[model samples]
Target: MNLANTLAAFPLAVRKFNPRLLVHSPVMFTVFIGSLVCTLVSIQQLVQGSPVAVFSALVTVWLWLTVLFGNLSEAIAEGRGKAQADSLRAARTSVMARRRLAGPGGPGTFTEELVPGTELAVGDIVVCEAGDLIPSDGDVIEGLASVDESAITGESAPVIRESGGDRSSVTGGTMVLSDKIAVRITAASGKTFLDRMIALVEGSTRQRTPNEIALNVLLASLTIVFVVCVMALAPMANFANALPTPVVLVALLVCLIPTTIGALVPAIGIAGMDRLIQRNVLATSGRAVETAGDITTLLLDKTGTITYGNRRAVEFGPADGVAPFRLIAAARLSSLADETPEGRSIVDLALEQGDGQPAQAPEELSADVEVIEFSAVTRMSGLNLPPGYPANPGTRVLEVRKGAAAAVERYALERGGFVPQELEEKVLEISATGGTPLLVATFDGTRAQVLGVIHLADVVKPGMKERVAQLRAMGIRTVMITGDNKITAGAIAGEAGVDDFVAEATPEDKLAVIKREQEAGRLVAMTGDGTNDAPALAAADVGVAMNSGTSAAKEAANMVDLDSDPTKLIDVVGIGKQLLITRGSLTTFSVANDVAKYFAIVPALFAATFPGLGLLNIMGLHSPESAILSAVIFNAIIIVLLVPLALRGVKYRAVSAAKALSRNLLIYGLGGVIAPFIGIKLLDLVVALIPTIA
Candidate 1:
């Protein structure tokens, strides 16, 4: 085993006597007294008789004590390291395996043994049975099933998967729900979609946060101080007879050093991470949590972040002087074959608005008509009526419900019909208030028939604006990225009070925007919930994926939010900042405590050298055993006190880096100085309260 690993595996009691532990000044002081006690006893025994046995017995006892304590401390550190490793491994295990079926002639039978370069023919059933892992990335050829993609996406719910030509694609590692699926492997084993996701999650482990590096440096520097203190004090105390034996001095030094360092720091970090988990936020990488506190920019997906993703139709308009019932019937008839939310809403409104019983089926109308499907890019739905409808001669009406006021206005202007000025004004007003207004019109060649406007609005999530304000208060710039046009994006951004907006952005465009922002040296935190956002989320400095988001997005993000609340970003940033501060405070106190131990030990070493100076006697006032006990107890107590602080999380306010640094210094430095005195004094009181020493 390596030195660090070996020390960690050692028993706690044995580790207490490790040379590294005793190297601290406080421990060395204790060892100096222990050696003095040993030598004085040995000399007395020699003067009396049986010098050989007496010397041998004393040496054996001293060596046994040293080894026992050293091994004890080593064991404690080792156990803690092992536990941390176990937690990390558990996190890795959460990545589910992807599996695919193979024929007898195929490269592998079982999914577990499948290699990267395996090939398969078309129509071959790649079965993904219940509880079976997905083996490769492929489109579902058959079967309807739900996949539990939480591990991959951070989403808590299971997603339904169905087979079709181009619409359904299954990733590796997703659990098959009800029925088995036959998939044609699109990507080979290691190159599958799940494999890439696993690679991404695994890659996060390599990136260490600034806090972790700082703690490591602090520990290394303290270790050096500890070793130097032991080396310088051992001989000086031995020559002056302050410590009668060198072995006692060495043992004390070993106990003191490791007690303060190896045992304390890791404990604080582990506890802090556990606390963060309890807050419903999983920080896949420690660095992510660290960076969250310092994030200066937050890029949000507009659809699901600030606004409820579902779109609902709220208003319908028909031409004046025309019966409202006729308009309703036409809209219902035209929308019957459509399944989009807007179409469904119109059909429902027609049914509700009609005076008598609603038409049981749209196909029964027998009206010769033309239907145009709504496309995301065009943002419109259209229907053309034939002369057969309404059973009246010379009646032709074209019904259109289109998104974006600008597109509809242009279409109307081209038709030589000016949209009423009041209608245009109303549309602008609604758009400004964050409502998506769709213009519904009915026209028959000659004089245009203006159907009343239909307004469909995406619901605003409560408290979203307040959360955006909080992020801003913390100095995080909020940018809204959406596929919606300029008007819709602007309206939402204004309502949400976002700092900036990027409209008409596709998934690829979003990625480009993120890259541009990154090039500007901004630490961007991207929040998203769809597969389209995977690249951008991955490219961000800190990717926060919602629990309800697509598996791809979740896989790409460094952190997952169970609540999926955009406002939770505020909480995350707060927790991250507090974690860094807590860790910094703990490390600072640990090192400062080592410095105090040196002060307590160094002055005493010289007290006996000059009787007039009274250095050696002053040093002898407290035995090495007492000093070692005091240091170990103090170190352990500090760790215990810090547990609650990490659990509670530090209260952080948004401030400049300078202010933050200054505040942290004051809290850590002042706390470090005062903690030991109070801790040691309490120990002394408790010791005094005891009946007697053995």
Candidate 2:
């Protein structure tokens, strides 16, 4: 632990000593009562000049430390988040917005006004330029620009925010680096995502997760059982002629209860959220983080999540008797002026074939050349070169095109050209291999002929197979949803190692898949970015939306990945399981610690009256007073020792739940039983040296 953090949290820990706040935790509150009772007994003994006064006062001080140490652990976890919230608050200061005035010519047509960002509301249009901070959370309505989101995400690299698509949403406090854009505000004034994140990290909006609540109930019940047992011990002690002092009885009761786990529960929960924040993920509720551990079915979107979303040209298959170079040349020429990802890939592949030589830039094309953009209706994109343009010196115009197999073949057939018989076979082979077949063709005035096929594929992301296997090992079934043919989806799924897949799925189908999985009693998690994904994102148990996704998707999801990584759900799941494991392990250690305490204090309390009980005192301490004081001191000191572990959380491994349980039990449970024996005996040796206890 940093010395600065400990010093800062001490005051906050002191503030948490109020009974109104302490009463919420039943076990800790019982300890608080025991501390007060011991304090009074110590005062009574001191006034009467009893030699036991010093021993009683030391026990009283340690009991109070036990409660304070618990508060300090929780305060340390909260302080980390409070510091982050303060930084976010600074960035959230009101800025000047270039609000576009609605004039007679309509919105964004004429003038602008400088208004406070806080004054802006939903549907208000604002213009942002280079070096200007984005005024508020909104969707870019017009233009495009490079935005620096360092203030919000802590990443210095600039990202592009443009009109339309998944990357349209812009956050306030992010600076516009280049170009200009008209943004239509989507969030209300004090209700931005930043405000929500600030509240979450500050611990104000945190609520106890179901697992935490259930564990609390169990701890309370155990505390009650121990309380009855301690009361019964008093009568038994009197009957045996070995009545213990009031302070000794209180010390024994405090040591026997499960104080270790009771004190660290809040710290464990808070630290879980802190881990997520450090990973650049913002979960709306602690419940979502907890639920991630229980997710049995992971419904992942095929595009951008499992695969790299876009299909790129990887190979060129020429028609029989046609040179490979001819096919590559035609593919490159048709895609030179094309701006689409597929088109750029084609040019790149062509260059790779030529030993990485640079090709003619798109801007180098003459004015006579025209670019034919691809559309749903045409299903093809190409270039039309007029005569005497570039390397062509013919009288007739040359038209080069590349697109879907059927679309390009139909174009050749209509233009008095024919598709080669072998080209059809080539297309099927590519399709069977899960690659898109784009036919490249050329026409000069009257005659047209098919050149070859371009093999484009949506490549599966690297390490997906290993990642899926890890999830499988943890008993999670991976399902992929895609809008492709069954053959394509199956090929990709096989390569990615997913357990199942939904082919040719639509938005409704995606939602139905999530609902069906949930109906079968499985927790489903999915990631999406488009407006069409909103319903499904909301329906899934753990919905993680990409930061680059549209506003609708971000609003509907329960968690947001600030870095826009689709696979971050894996880390979230790991963190959630770690939180549960940490809580369970500490609970085991706390209960096992009681085993050693019982041996140290129980025998000393009765061994004087019942000689046979002396065998239980294996530690062989000097006296009953020394044994009781040592157990009390150990109980208080252990809370402070485990504070760092509670705030940092237990390490999580991607394994089955049974395996994790066994591992934790072996380490924390068995170790817990042995640790306190050594600790208590060591403390006894030290306490015996003190004249009052001896």
Candidate 3:
């Protein structure tokens, strides 16, 4: 096929669209039209026996070839991507299930093809197993098994399931693990959870941000400028009888209106995302890297992101008369049956303290006269003991341990005996230092004994303090948000060096806080790892989720850290700054190159009669062919040099706003001016070394 016809046919065949080709940049179309005009002028001159017409025809032909090649390259690349996606979709379909018989006498197998809303009968086995995708959404009728839910949830964890009733739902594409199960189809193939998840991912891919649209617009504008410049100058040159002027103008248009700019822009973004992958971070949106650097506030979840997220009992104090070991034994036994993280921590600490052996089971503990289960409102649990062997008989004391400092203290004051002011002061002091204080109280129906305190602390991550300092240095405010009580949250925030702390914050509260920060003109970055944290993560300017986090968190976050290290935030921010600088530098240099083309080609076109203007043209740079060759070579070299810059990011710090703007303008703007002279000199030297045809 001819070049124009091939370019037109390619996109339709591949199901791809190029907006640039559709709108038809007037400037570029003008350049093409100008070349056609020059060809006509050259033909007229040839008929009139003018030698200059031959050179003009050559230049016109060269420009057409260049434009043709550029368009063809773009069509091929786009076609390859579309073909690959189509192939993947086909492969996915092939692996999907088709109807099969479940044996004779079992619902009487029929040849009727099933569609959406097809009712499934009981005892009909859907026949799904490991790696064999389920054909439809269903509920388990019989058997028990585990299923891999990675495809739907983005969580690689396997979930165990047991057959019961209508509430048990199974998704298509999930892999069955271990035992096989009979599932009665609830929803047909197209309406399953898997279908919905697939739709969400596909929809996400289609949603482009404003920045991406702006970049595309800029590229389109440049293309138009290149085309217009060529069209305007080509006819004027024909009137001057300038030899090779039209050919050189055609070549200049091809070189200046680089079609690759549009193609390469997306390629650069993809490459940046690849770099993030190497660092064990997944960038959900291609533009996230750019957005991350602009963040002014960082909101971190207190549990996993700041503290170790695991609780461990660290300190113990007994009542004045009670022995320390006795209190420990009672606490250990009380925690034995508890599965909460705090209870486990207490039991584990007690075991370790008593020579690495767990406390005897709850059944083995001294008979409890009365037991108070943990209550969220009261924040305490207790076992009331009857006065026995050695102690006073009327002292029917309740041994209690609770989470919150204020609640425990208020309970102590209401049922007071010995105030234990010293103990209370010590516990409050520890709480302020970021330790979780558990109040151990003994109450005898009316009066309460203020027993000693038990402190459980979340382990601090190594280098956490230094990392927080680095964030502060970068002018990014760091805040801790958690569901933990005020004392525990404040304690961890202090130890982690966070600038602010919000305690007892729910998912909605976190979202509100983020919105508030944004309203104050801060770009907020939030890190979270819970289903509850999904809304806040989505609301933030940039959301970073741990790879080990809940599926909802990962799906909502802009970035995921595969290593689950919060410190990678620093590395990502650095990469974002580098990308911005690199893009800025490339754009400045590209525009400057176009400006230089105007200087080189315009003067040479008016050179024949305007002798003084011709004098302005450098020797050996008289023809459009030479200028076309120079511009193309220069463009290629600039793109090549940019490869290393993109790969190895620029080194930058979180500096004052003024300093940052000054540095960027100087490095990108001024640097663009200096680079071309050096590049041109190098190119001249290379050209001089090559042997020329006579």
Candidate 4:
């Protein structure tokens, strides 16, 4: 945290000591009660000039400091979150929207009224043109545009948002860079994506995860056991003719309980979210963050997650009798009006082949040319050329189609055209190698002929194999889910180095995989960016949605990756595991240090009454008062010293769980039992110099 945030959190730390609030953490609250009792007893002793008044007062002061230090750790963590929230809030500035009038007027039918963005409500249609700020979170209902979403995703590269697909969702506060789109706002004012992100980082809505709740219960139970043991000591000490002071009993109790972990638990959890924000991810709940730590199987979509989503034309395979030039010209002419990545790739590949003079641009084509966009039902797209066109000077209009081999073949057959036997073999050959075959055909109203096949190669993203290897090293199995056939899916999965593959999987299939893994008692994580993925996203133990995904997908998922990077789950899992490891390590140290405190205080409490107890004073402290005071001071100071570790979290190593456990036990456990002995004994040497205590 910066100086400004730390300073702001200080008062908040003090205010959190309110009894009503402190009561929620049973262990810390017990320390609070002990501090209160010691405060009252010290005041009474000082008034009556009791011999041990100074010692009682010193113990009382340290006990209070112990509790305050714990509060400071949590406040500082929260302070960091508030700082992030303020910056996010700045992006939610007001802008004017061109509200569209709801009528049959279609695309350009706007009301001519510039309404403030905050005035827009859900289902209101707003038109966003080049250089205009998108009014609110919504889906593109008309047209398409290149939008600058750096304000939300922190990515300077613009992304495409178009109608009728998974890439349609647009966030408010993002700027439209090119073209115009009519957006039907999906969220009301103050309920935008930006608003939700601000709330998440502010941590006002953070709830404890299940594991954290269980750990808290365990700590409370240990506190109660220690309380009973300390209370029983009072009667035992009295019988020995050496009754310990109430302040002494209070100090012993505070040091003996698991105060260290109790104080840092909230800080550790908050720091986990802060780390996720640094990675440009927003988690809706702390439970999701913790669940990420336990994920054993990760289900990933093949297109974007494993391989680059864009399928590009790599080669051309012609029909047996057609000339290569004839096939290239037909493919180029059909794709000129198509705007998809694959279509654009076909045009680029055709031009690179250099068959003839540069082809005419889509705009230069005659106005009679009709552009037929691809649809799920048709599974094909092409241009319907008018008769006497430059490429088709025949008396009848020409239908130039390029799409799925089956769709184009069916179109050719209906017009009395037969699929070339050789071309069918070429389609199967491409599919076997994980390439999509787009059959190109031409029909002049009377005769139809299959022209060629465009081989669309799916490129596996770079470094995918290494990422899959890293997940495997962490004992997580990576499974690739794809709609591609088994042969194609296997090729991509092998190239990506994932452990498993699911072919021809639907949205329901994705959900079933999550349930099956969960039934086997393994936590699962998955990523998605479409409405079809909403069910699987919600079903997975840890669901991460891309910021560019539809509102339904984003709402169902627990985490949102603002940069829309599907591979970010790897880093997220590491951050989550670090959070759990930090808590576990600190808890080991906390419980271990109690071993030293017990030896230091127990021997001093009865050494004079029972001479044999001196044998247990291994540190051989100057006196009973100095030994007790030294341990109390060490216990209180350790909390302040550990605040940084709690906030920064422990560095996680991707080793097996057993190796990690063994390593942590060797370090924190052994170190915990040893460090306090040295620290308390050193403190004893200084405490012995005090004339009153000596």
Which candidate should be chosen as best, given lDDT against the real structure? 4
Model 3 score (lDDT)? 0.60
The better candidate by TM-score, 1 or 2, is: 2
Model 2, span 425-490: residue lDDT tens: 888777777777899998888898798899998888899999999899878899999877787788
Q: For each candidate, what is the lDDT?
A: 0.58, 0.88, 0.60, 0.88
Using TM-score as the measure, the top candidate is 4
The stretch of ten residues in a row with the least summed lDDT in candidate 2 is 388-397
lDDT per residue for candidate 3 within 1-694, as digits (tens), equals 2355445535552332243552333333434555577678768878988655555555566444433333343343233234323332332232334343554656755333342233443333465555665555666666767876554444577775456521245655567876777666655445543443333222224333356567767777776776676677666677777633545665566556643344344434544554565576767665687787677888877666677777778877665776776557656644655656888778777667662444555565456445566776888765656665122222454454444556667877877755476777877777777777777666667776655677877777888888888788778899888777687677788888999989988778899999999999998988776667789888888888765455557668888775567657767876766566555555555555555555555565566667777655553462544444455455445544554443344566667768866776677556655565456545545544433300
Which clashing pairs does model 2 show?
none
Candidate 4 local distance difference test against the native: 0.88
Name the Cα RMSD for model 4. 2.7
Which regions in candidate 4 have their CA more than 4 angstroms from the true location? 1-5, 94-119, 129-132, 177-179, 357-361, 391-397, 418-422
TM-score of each candidate structure, all chains considered together = 0.70, 0.92, 0.70, 0.93
Q: Which of candidates 1 and 2 reaches a greater lDDT?
A: 2
For candidate 1, the lDDT comes to 0.58
What TM-score does candidate 3 reach?
0.70
Q: How many backbone clashes does candidate 2 have?
A: 0
